[model samples]
Target: MSATEHATCLAIAAARAAADKKAEHLAAIDVSERLGLTDVFLLASGANDRHVHAIVDAVDEAMHRAGAKRRTREGFADAHWVLVDYGDVVVHVLQNEDREFYSLERLWKDCPAIELPADLAHGGSRDGDSLGGRETTAS
Candidate 1:
């Protein structure tokens, strides 16, 4: 009833890739107990269509590098929101407005959140480059 270790690792890798693309408000929720198809949901927001696509591409590439194959992808043409299903981990790269409107975190509020590394969460990686282009301050 929990995310497997491989799934967790893949989700974290996807999260970092999203961060590298300047995706905002990144979150990974363990949906193992609620969903039979996937164990984790990795959510991220982009400022616009281009940003959303970029984040999705980054996440896909990172996951593949980690040996996870994408099962399917949705909403790529519009780029309003993109869902990359990686079997164990499902990644959502969404536009800022869409992210606010959907409020996935609220929908899956009961799910346990996966803890990302401080450096990655803070947008500071080992390369010393800020992961995201713009930082959103907590209100």
Candidate 2:
């Protein structure tokens, strides 16, 4: 299935919010050309439970403001990993320990990374280096 630009933009906004919350290993995967369920997979890691929760909240709020509704959310209470399903995109907010243990990046290595815009990648600024971000627009 293919995702519209609006969906992708909203996903990017969500990813930015996660990064603003200081989530580690932040990355977005453009799976639209290859996957049936969603267009992008935004993954981020928090240092601990509280940070994980905060990241999730920030993303959710930003997405909601962007008119994206979450279809499902899991693992909030434990905060080891929180999966926020936003129909066209799926966001995985994980704790540092859980992220290392799960290593979703390795699992989805075949999928190319989603590259954010210069300003967004650097959190509204363009000074920092790329945070392992990548993307594949529709062919």
Q: Which stretches of candidate 1 lie over 4 Å from their true place?
A: 122-139
Worst 10 residues of 1 by lDDT: 129-138
Each candidate's number of clashing pairs is 0, 6
**Global local distance difference test of model 1:** 0.80
Candidate 1's residue-wise lDDT over 1-139, tens digit each?
7999999999888888988987777777889999999999988888899888888989988988999998999999999989999999999888767876777877887788877656566332223322222222222
Stretches > 4 Å off in candidate 2: 1-3, 118-139
Scored by lDDT, the top model is: 1
The global Cα lDDT (0 to 1) of model 2 is 0.75
